[model samples]
Target chain A: MDQRPPDHITAAPSLAAKPPIVTLDGVSKAYANGTVALRDVNLSIGRAQFVSLLGPSGCGKSTLLRLIAGLGDLTGGRIDWPGSAKASDGTPKRDLGFVFQEPTLMPWANVFDNVYLPLKLGRLSRKQARPRIMDALAMVGLEKFERSYPRELSGGMKMRVSIARALITRPSVLLMDEPFAALDEITRFRLNDDLLRLWAGRDWTVIFVTHSVYESVYLSNRIVVMGARPGRITADLAIDAPYPRSEAFRMIPAYNEYCRMVSAELHATMGEASPE
Target chain B: MSTSAEPVAQRADRRLIALRIALPILVGVVFLGTWQILVTWLQVPKFVLPAPSLIATAFVDDFASLMGSLWFTLTVTVEAFILAVVGGVALAVLFSQSEIVATALFPYAVILQVTPVVSIAPLIIIWVGYDNVRVALLILAWIVAFFPVLSNTTLGLRSTDHNLRNLMQLYGASRWRILTEVQFPSALPYLLAGMKISGGLSLIGAVVAEFVAGSGASTGLAWRIIEAGNRLDIPRMFAALALLSVLGIAIFGVLSAFEYLMLRHWHESAVRREN
Candidate 1:
């Protein structure tokens, strides 16, 4: 393995904050069609840690995220919450925010209503959610687009709204599934920076899924590179760099070095899959 | 997108709108002119087909009698339409909930529609007697026109965005709330489109039933058409036909306008794009 620090590796923040709050044990997933998507995978996520599930396509990264969110039931294994583990928490997994590959917004709804959907569905009335919705919209830099419909929005803005919706719930664990893959390069870059800033500010545990190595390196503190064809974890690279990452960091030699290493790893992973 | 020709563009747009409005009127005038020429030139027998001017004169001369029949027809059409809407939607909601029952009864609805109104109107008139015969006839007409609306609306409800449906489910929206907020709103355009089609259909049904009624009940435009035909008032018959045609067009136009207004904000179908 290459030893150079990732160019976009964020600076190590003070660890006095917290330890990992989430634990998964022997998580094996098999579809109804007898296709095994994940097998005996184990992962533990820390509080406020941004973990990128970096992998080739069909890595079951998204499925794993869904299992965590309680959107999907695991065929085997258990997701344990240390502090809040209980049988009687009436609050559903909907409280856990999920950003899908597509924005998955209600096309009929305006930005404000779409942002407020979760909260409103949680039994909060429109009046109660007005300020919170506005705040979320502002968090995503879409303050001026409250009345705009999804069809009118650009892909980046729509994804931002999705992010805002995920954030609006103040979710402890945010699940993202390649939300920015559809965007152009420039838009993706800006969104990446915005995402990091937001992640830093909120201190929420984020489990992100992406096929892009540069993206995984840029935003993740821990990159979980996965392999497909009956998905399995191949590598987990920890990113140790400084925070408040700027556009300048992407240009540094270290950043390029990390990109090359990840690219090589990805290329090798693809080659290995071809023969099998 | 340039601002320089904005006002000029605005003028051109308004002119375009005016032309769109004028084109239909121009077409109608031309159509009437051709019809009048054909009748006059061919010396088509007046009893068979009267000229437009003759029809107009007959309409004015028999205004009092025609007005009474028109009122009756209008009432039946309105009543039948209202019943169709209220009953169709209620049944649709019921049917949407139970797939088994919906499947069982949907074929029956089709059977009801396919069974000719003439065959049923006479039976209904006899069963209900004279005073309520017209209403019975109207109901017969309505049943046929209503099935499309119900089926279309239910399909629309069923076809709502899966993401939105999941979102609602995640939020733990109650069945009633989901139905009202998501399913119903999504179904509105489809329901309205069906209504536009059924509006004209219901009118025709009412008229046909009235024609079948002969003279026992004078409820719809069909009776007037029959009366004029029986009396050999050819121009009066044309006048009645014209009124029926205009009424059908007007009903459809009204429903379409309502659809446009309702969907203007939310649906792409109703959204007007800049020229």
Candidate 2:
């Protein structure tokens, strides 16, 4: 093997450290109404894996994602990262990107401005961020819609703008909460394919929340099936599907079998009654 | 030709617009003809119910004096409306900054609005000591006319999109930037609607105040009505009343057109064709 470069080349240890993107130790969340949403969820996601929190409604899947996104604090556990200490004592490090179910685009902003919001928030000059914004919009296939307002776009197009906005930050971890549930079946399938394409290309981790068994099976490398009535993780399944998954894959028996299994698990999860 | 189909649709639309205009004029003619016939048959006194022809003749005879007072009333209305927009929008922005201050001063604004300017004009006349009290009376009318706009605009400012509001917060937008960019733009339709209502109200207020505050020179239409009544010039009084009604319709029409143009693309109220 060739020896490494000289001292100058090896100097100032790389600040590009690949720390664990998410570390939740015994994270429990109880709402103000005394309803425990999540109980002692111990999870670790690696740097660039696409993981899905698959569950029915009221399964604390969104709660878990919000915890990871630093949107809300855990009631009885700790979430830690390298820069967690310097974030003003209790303020979590604002690093994760989140996409909500409703596109939630600013109604007054055009597509380009919406995509540039986070970067502008990060104090980058508009000229400095313009190229990156355009590139992100192009990645979402909304390059021509840069001047169009949110109300003028279709539902699917608005969600694409949202995804573009999320990706413009180039964050390490992306959190989504049922982003495609409101979309039609066809648009949902298209977006699922596009998301997988983006996931395959970028060196970024994702934690997607969805109630759709088919969606969970299709986009994720690993699926965490959660049950309600105090919201616990019941099954964790690894999808051994290959990359660059196409619409043609859905017609295959293997894909059908996986969808059937996840659907059955989801049905079972929703059918579970509370324990006395 | 395809152009033939387009001109056919255009002709249909033009006919539709013409019918729209013709129908209203037809309705007005029918109403006046009925009124003239009924009153002539009923033999009503001329002082109580002058015929449309008599009123028209009186209007033509006294056209010069009537036009002068009409101009005076219009000038006061325009001046008062400008003052209200400037003062009201400023006060609204100031109140939006501090809730405690808004809550404290809002009752005073309500009192100022509801209290009749007619009763107050005499006192103002004594204080200002002249017919220049017309300006003060116009100011008083304008205050009432604009506060609803101030309050409505303030509410609209506070009722911004929550997620977008959060986005602004995360972006560290200053209070003024948020006000000008997000809050003000969102509140525009509401403010304009309030302005539409308030524009007519300001004109009414101007005439009403002029009735009480006019001295010798700048007598508005309201004062002319009073002068006609004192002289038993019943048809002339009706003519002044007609001019006032025309003034009101003109003010409201101008405001509605402005509202339509301003919000045509964005707001539902102003959008013409929806798919």
Candidate 3:
């Protein structure tokens, strides 16, 4: 396992003073077959922060996110959701929502039903969740297609339904694993814009995982660069760009500079490898 | 899949549906006409090859007896089919809920499937008692019909999307809720597919079992075929055979329609793409 400490690009003095919403201290995950997916990753995400776990393939970015979501067990160390309230299901994790890389909508379920899943599992009645489900659908611009099944929707629309499903419960922490990676650029950009709009002016923590530097830079305030071959964090840097970050933000030099920095850091992280 | 030319699409869809029904019927009429004309033109013997008209007449003459046999055969077929569905689905669910149970018993299920029911029909008939041939027939038919549903439903249950399972787990859904809401529904198309196969097999099983039991064992269509064959009443035999074919077609049609109804909304097999 790679034991080197993560090199912070800026040391993040701005975030150092604030209390973290989640703290990952030396969180390590090794499979039973002896493959180390992650190792000694320390991360403290502040409340409402948009953090991106960015890396090349096999970097365990996804594994880290899953560990944080309580979807998988860590073989070493621990994760703590500090000050989190116990969800109605009796887990502190219910205050969280997860969006997989795939849209992951139930193929048998229509739009309204797919969005209704999270709440439905919480034992909320369909009648009780109707308005909220509609609200979530409208937020994703799919109010007219409630009866449509996942097979009927375009890839982008399916992802929108997935997003709606994730947001229906209004969880404090939203974990998205490259949610827009499979979409076309036009769709991806539109979804990126939609996601940023939703994240704006709300106290929601979103830990997004992506291999795309531009995506990580555009969507997240802080990007944690990771390395493969016993996946470990290599660098952490803050975007520090102002919000309501518009398309015009993409055209600006500072945005390009941040992207270039992230790209270089990511490329460097990709360089050190014990070949498989 | 809906297009802006809604009326045109609707008309085309209607035409397609009409063609599906009409083409088969038109072919059947032409086939019968040719068969009748050739038989009459060639002076074929009545016993050698009866024309469609002679078969029709024989059908009319034996209507009461044929209907009684059909009803009996259908009862056994339907009863066996229902038992197979219940047994298969129940066994599959039990297997899915416990790995140890599945591991211990799945090989025996495979063994039952591989061993031909025809080979065992007489043995089963003897074992169940010659006096209770109907119970024997039911047992043989259920054995023949239940495996497909069992295997297919098990596969469907196992094939539940990993991501969906994780999503449900993340939501903290009860195991029962996950089984009913996700696994059961996911398994429906597979179960239905298996049932369609089983529907036909159950009929065959009932007939095969009755055939082995021989004359006086039951008043089923298979028995009528056997009885007619013994007397060289070829036309009556033809009539019984025709009825059996019709019954088979009807069973398939009903099961296909039911499958379409259950799956037309979401399953890929049932959904029609305009493109």
Model 2: native contacts recovered, as a fraction: 0.23
Q: Who wins the DockQ comparison?
A: 3
DockQ, structure candidate 1: 0.41
DockQ of each: 0.41, 0.31, 0.73
Error of 3 at A266 (Å): 1.4
Check candidate 3 and list the clashing pairs.
Answer: none
Runs of candidate 1 exceeding 4 Å displacement = A1-20, A84-94, A260-276, B1-4, B37-43, B94-98, B113-130
**Which TM-score value belongs to model 3?**
0.94
lDDT of 3 by residue, B77-127 (tens): 999999999999999999999999999999999999999988998888888
Binned by DockQ into CAPRI classes (incorrect, acceptable, medium, high), candidate 3 is medium
Clashing pairs in 2: none
Question: Distance from true position, residue A76, model 3, in Å?
Answer: 1.3
For model 1, residues A1-276, the per-residue Cα lDDT tens digits are 444545455333332135656778999999999999998887777877888888877888888877776666889988777755453664433346778888888767899988987887677899999999898899889999999988788999999999999888788888888989999999999999998888886767888999998888788777777777778777666676567777888888766666666666665666642211
Ranking by TM-score: 3, 1, 2
What proportion of the real contacts between chains A and B does each prediction keep?
0.33, 0.23, 0.67
Q: DockQ score for model 3, please?
A: 0.73
Candidate 2 structure quality by residue, lDDT tens digits, B1-275: 37768788778889999999999999999999988998898988889988888899999999999999899888888888877777777888888888898999988888888888788767866786674767676776686588768877877888877656654654446788778767787888778888887888788788777777666645888889988898888999999999999999998899898888877655767655533
Residue B104 local lDDT, model 3: 100
Of the two candidates 1 and 2, the one with more favorable lDDT, higher being better, is 1
Q: Residue A4 in model 1: shift from native, Å? A: 10
